[model samples]
Target: MDNKIVVITGGSSGIGRALCNCFIDAGYKVAIASRSVEILEKVKSDLRSEGHEILTVKTDVRVDNDCKNLVDKVIEKYGKIDVFINNAGITWYESNEDGINIKKHKEIMDTNHFGTVQCTKYALPHLLKSKGSLVGVCSIAGEVGLPNRSAYSASKFAMNGFLNSLRVQYLNKGLQVLITYVGYTSTNIRKIVKDDSKSSHFPPGYGDAVKEKGMMTPAEAATHIFNGVKKRKRSVRSSAVGQLTVWLNKLFPRLNDKLAAKYYS
Candidate 1:
């Protein structure tokens, strides 16, 4: 991985942060972007001490300009981009009872769906220049609708559709596009759960403990992602459980629906 230029968004925390550490250890020059400059800076500082080239950029994926700036900065500094990972995302706890909280739903769409679109669009040219790979960390949620997370599921579903179309278009260019179906990962996203009471339409349950039981650690998830990128795989599903979820959803949609309803309840 030495001398390879890799850009990861939402790199300040969770799976993204773990990827930063792994790639750096493999001798790659890595640039991490996120809305949190403080954490990014700390990550950069820590990696630099080990003689790894690291760049941290504060970015809000909701902004097109920020995405452009991220890619531009990477190119200006490294001369070429070998891989682009669109990992920035947000998730909310909703039960579908009163319908999704309009504000939170919009926020999820803006950050997870639209934000990914913006970053992918901006990075396309740079990636094309090097015939680089593009990766999106979608979820098993993308494969099937969950009971409580209407908007979050919809956004991920949309990401899958959009990236699939993009992959076909880029295939002829000798560029690879990979999207992953990640089950659970020990990420700060669960710890930061938003209270739906503030937004009455939203569901009430917080997912902190639930996620702890179902997901792998961020480091474990990062390892799957690293191997996927290194192999230039068309798609990477993080674990057997995640892949099984997709298959079960496809074969027994109603069964899973009932099970999910009970699980959420």
Candidate 2:
């Protein structure tokens, strides 16, 4: 994979950042996209000091032109794309008691679902040409809805469906689509919700609950995702818990529903 090119969005932090390091260690050329120019520069500088080179692009995935420019820039630098990871996403914590916030839901959907779609649209041709992998960093919430995560769940479900459809459509076309169902991971994603007002409504102890010791680290999650992409897997569960939740939901729908409610509560 030394000469192969990999593109990752949301690449300045968390699992995305870990993935950049993982791929670099494996000798693949990496290009990262993020909305924050400062964060991108910082990551680039840190990696450069460690003797790894990377291309950084300022991109807001929610914008179509930005997504297009991201792919264009990567192709300009690397000539071809071997893997494109749709990892840019956001979430909110809100309960039914907090009242439905359509605006918040739309905001999440725009980033999580539509952002993935836009990036895929521009990157598809390149991926197809190289028989490359297209990956979605989805969540367990996509497999089974969780309480207080209506917006996040809906967006992920949409993403899952979209990626699944692409996998089928391109099955014989030599394009690989991989969806990773990630469970709770030690990432600051939860803390970066754009809506402070709604995030403040998170139930007491919710943060502690999510930060339990068993949660996977971003590096661990990145390893799972990297392996899946390397093997051209159709799907991967990032944790034992995530795998169990998906299977239980499939075999015991109602029971899983009740368990999900209790767990999130």
Candidate 3:
């Protein structure tokens, strides 16, 4: 994978960060894109100090022009984009009870679904040139409508449909579109979850470490993603829960809904 150019959004932390590390260790040129310049710079500095050359581009995937710029900048440096990972997404643990937060839902949808579409659209031409891979870091929430995650689920479901359609459209053309269904993992995402009023706050009963319990580590999930990329899997589940959720959603849709409510309601 030496010289392989991999671009990851939301690469400052969590699964994206792990993916960055994996690609760096594999001797691939990496570009981490995100809106947070401070965090992105910190991650880049930390990695570079360890002798891994990386590029941290300040990008907001939600912006159409920014998406185009992301592709343009990568191509400027690498001449081609070997892999583009659509990992930049946001969601809040608000109300799946009283109602959905319109403000929060729009934000989630903009960043997760439409954002992925825009980036993929901008990168498709380059990907076609390289016959490379397009990865969508969707969540199990997108696969099955779990309680407390309506917006997250909607965005992910939209992403699945969009990318799946593209996968079929480009199949004979040698492009690989991979979507990952991820279960809960230890990440800073929870720290940024918003309340019903749209203010970011930790949810009730939430603990820093407990939010990570019984969940796959981001590094572990990143390994699965990397392997899925290497194997050219069309779709991958990062955890057993994600796999089982798919099965249950198919065979027992009502049961899945009820069980999800029982656990998360």
Candidate 4:
């Protein structure tokens, strides 16, 4: 995969940033897109010290035009795209006093679901040409809905559905589609956990315990992601605990929910 042109969204922080470094270490020409161009530039400069070819593009994945421009600019600079990683995402712990609200639902869905679709629309042609891979950084939440994450769960569920259908759609075209159900990996995402009380429907210390248990570091998660892409695995689950969740959800969705409540509630 040396010199492969790889594009990753949400490349400014956490798993996205870790992926940027891992791909560069593997000798791939990497382009990272995110809203924080300042932080992105800092990361690029730091990596350049190690002699990696990295490009930064400011992008709001929620916008179709921005996604288009990201792809266009990458191809313009690198001439081809070998892989596209849809890693940009956002989450809110609570939405309303009742349960999940339409406002938060729209925001999360737009960023995590539609944002991925928009990027795929722009990158599909390039991927097809290169016979490349399309990887979506979904969550274990995609497989099993969690308390206080109705909207976030819905968005990941949508991503999983879309990618599953897309895999079948592009099979004959030789496009490899990977949908990953990653579990809790310590990243800045936890810092953004909404003050659920402000929204009035907090999940009663939902994040407190889970944050300590079964959480891997960003570098650890990125290593798993890199391996999945390199092996061209159909689906990647980060941890043993994560794989158990995926299987249990598949085997008994309702049962998994009851178990989540037992543990998190």
Against the unseen true structure, what C-alpha lDDT does each candidate score?
Answer: 0.82, 0.89, 0.85, 0.84
**lDDT pick, better of 1 and 4:** 4
Error of 2 at 260 (Å): 0.4
For candidate 4, write residues 1-265 as lDDT tens digits.
3389899999888899889889888888999999987898898888878777688999999999999999999999999999999999987776445575788799899999999999999999999999999999999888877777889889999998988899999889988898888777767675565433355333333354336445777788888888888998889998786687668878998888788766533
Which residue runs does candidate 4 get wrong by more than 4 Å? 95-98, 195-213
Model 3 vs. true fold: TM: 0.93
* Worst-scoring 10-residue span by lDDT in model 3: 194-203
Q: Report each candidate's C-alpha RMSD, comma-separated, in the order given.
A: 2.9, 2.1, 2.4, 2.8
Following a full C-alpha superposition, what root-mean-square deviation does model 4 have from the true structure?
A: 2.8
Candidate 1 residues 76-168, lDDT tens each?
Answer: 999888889999998876644556588988899999999889999988888898898898999888887876778779899999999999989
TM-scores of the candidates in the order shown? 0.90, 0.95, 0.93, 0.91
Rank all candidate structures by their lDDT, best first, as comma-separated numbers.
Answer: 2, 3, 4, 1
Model 3 local distance difference test score:
0.85
Task: Please report the TM-score between candidate 1 and the true structure.
Answer: 0.90
Q: Ten-residue segment with the worst summed lDDT in candidate 2?
A: 201-210
Candidate 2 lDDT over 164-190, as tens digits, reads 999999999999999999888877676
Q: Which has the better lDDT: candidate 3, or candidate 4?
A: 3
- Regions of candidate 3 where Cα sits further than 4 Å from its true position: 96-98, 194-205, 209-211
Cα-based lDDT at residue 215, candidate 2: 78
